[model samples]
Target: MKNMVKRYGFNVEASLPKVPNHPVESKEWLYGRTIINAVRVVMKAQDVQISIFGAENIPATGGALLAINHTGYYDFILGGIPAFVRGKRLVRFMAKKEIFDTPVVGSLMRAMKHVSVNRAAGASSMEDARKHIEAGELVGIFPEATVSRSFEIKELKTGAVRIAESANAPLIPLIIWGGQRIITKDIDRDLGRSHIPVFISVGEPVDTSGDPEVATQRLFEAMRTLLDETRHSYESQYGPFDGGEPWRPVSLGGGAPTLERAKLLEIAEKERRQAKRDAKKAAQAGGRRNPVTALIARLKKLIKK
Candidate 1:
């Protein structure tokens, strides 16, 4: 692991040519058909089965804001494939800038006319998303900003609602289950599992005409419900949540981290911290060597005696 980490240390900041964004046009439908069909072929080869529901809830035409729960790296494909295949439309996702900076991915995203967001650049991407929305593009966003380590829906960012309101587009809540177990940020949890069944549930368009904060909360609630339903659906077909839990780590067949292991880790961490503090205190006491003051004190003591 250490060698692999070191080998790939410099790739993130490696120099890559800038990729320009392509404007959405009539040809996009053709691109969507080709790309989505290709993805389905590949997934079929891997024996990956996908079940998508509420797809008709997506607006057949015009722009819409897709608020998705990010699970793992394959989330884009998982979310995009179902939407594209069902709706016969491509969703322009607001992806992280790093993806747009990578060599091949950057080119593909630009070609797909997806918006690139540099989190540190503040709200600059909002305007870009709004522009795409105004152009009648189905603009999708993973509102969690990043995948949650626990496989649970994390707090959503307000960007999706803001974009929806600004573009006067309806906000559609989407939930994806079982993507996290395939690949995850937690190295110990990732088993590189394939042939897993993934489920996607799309909710009706959420009204975003109200306050952005309120609308965002409403979206989160809807997404949470959809996520629960999707998880239940996944488990119903697969089996128990213990050994085959979709929300758990891949190591435990995707079950959540064990409580006993967590408790043991906590105790060990506390002991290590306490030992470091005690060692620091001992060193401070041992290093108290003020020779001049000690000599003067001893002479004064002798005179008094």
Candidate 2:
């Protein structure tokens, strides 16, 4: 806690005078600025460069629903960045009950005015989100609900469309590519390569009235199209996703280590260790020098001549 204060100033929980229930109130707090700036600082320090397109599509005011594809744990920050930078709107995202119940994390979530959803009873939180939207706040939802290992926009949930229709809010599609490369669910922890490029492409708001299934489909296609366009733009400027697709799952193109692959790697490492032990024991018993090292020394002596 003290280290966090020294690094990022007083904890957001301590510095705020009053907790914000709405986005408008939250944005006015110094805590909001602190968290946003902290994310920016971390992104910069990790060399995570962000590319944003179609930011003009975000409405400057009024209630809006952002439907962003979920790719990784860090994706919410990426999903919210375009809105934060362009529209200056603080997006309220609904988190699962488990996350919202965490001690430190829950405090931060409360400070940020994020809604907490009960996994078993999601409707209550959905109602809360609808109310926030009706109050003219920008609400963001990861319709996928979980990170997509395939890196492709997975099938989306109807919660976002339902919220938009209920609140009469415009549904804006947000697509983010390459965030999983920075960190993925496959590994316990992977501080990925520095200067990794993260692409965010926002699309025009879609109609939310009428059938929500159709609306959800439209949003999915829009996000898919934006993802493809962002990929093209990224590759055109930088390069391909190397020999393996940086964002895709290994089965697709992501090349992230999988459970089966990890197991094989572990076995191989154990075999190598056993072989080393066997070789050392044999050397000790026979009093034999390391042939490879002896050969290198002999070569060095001959070169001196």
Candidate 3:
């Protein structure tokens, strides 16, 4: 491992390019730029050495739907690096509504013009993404809908193909490996100078002109292939998985859960969230049925009459 690290690891200072002074039309607003600059500083401080491959596949001009695989919370940030490197393109990611409801982070997400998706009312968010793409903006979406605890490609939602077909944009498959080492599900985070080697790969735009189901399947296969290649390269350079590394996937003989187990965990999580929502709604209903509240309502109606 030491010899491989010495031979293959990169120096952060040498890997990153000089920050570009993006033009106003980039649509990276003042707050967005500030957040991105801060993120750059944080990434540098953490000594993250990112290697982006096939960045040229990201079109220099026009709308593109980046369908990225999700493994960790930082996937969104790391996944955007390729587009930025390609042509200073800022991707408007479609994230969950819970993140948008967050206090400071939510404000920043809005300021960055990210689209918020409500799982129950997702059409609005899809429409928002379509508009962004139609206007020649790059849009990013995690087709898996949530982080894959297995560190492998999960079954994808059809939103990626649907949005691309509707907006007449190219759907690009992208994958990021090694960000899971910094932060991921069921693991403690190490935000220090870990010098983690992060890998990002972009594949050619997928053909979304066909049936949505078929296009989604093709997109999934493309991402899975890209992920397999990236993971193999990462293990070759920085790993000889001893079958104990929590960050490595089970398929690679590491400690992460298998896809079947991860699916069960996701279902459990969804049920837990549903229970919480049900409790909250019941409490609200009980409040509305309070005798004092009912009396006030009746009095107001009588007065109006």
User: Considering every candidate listed, which one attains the maximal lDDT?
Assistant: 3
Q: Please, what is the whole-model Cα lDDT of each candidate in the order they appear?
A: 0.70, 0.72, 0.83
Scored by TM-score, the top model is 3
264 in model 2: Cα distance from truth in Å?
19
lDDT of 2 at 131: 90
Q: How badly does each model clash, as a count of residue pairs?
A: 3, 1, 0
Backbone clash pairs in model 1 (N, Cα, C under 3 Å; residues 3+ apart or in different chains), count? 3
Tens-place lDDT digits, model 3, residues 1-305: 11212111232223334344345434565534666677778888999988777666777777889999999989888877777764467888999999999998898888888899999998988999999999888899999999999999999999999999999989999999999999988988878998988988889899997788998999999999999998887889887757878888877988888999989999999899999999999999888787988999999999999
TM per model? Answer: 0.70, 0.72, 0.86
lDDT per residue (tens digit) for residues 1-305 in model 2? 11111112211112222222334533656445788877777876787767666665776667788898877888778877766654356888887888878999989887787888886888898899999888877788888876665566677888888998888888999888777767766544446447777777788988877788998888888888887776667667676556565455564355655535544654676699899999999988777667997799899999999
lDDT score, candidate 3, position 152: 91
Full-model lDDT, candidate 3 = 0.83
Candidate 1 error regions (>4 Å): 1-30, 187-194, 244-246, 249-254, 257-305
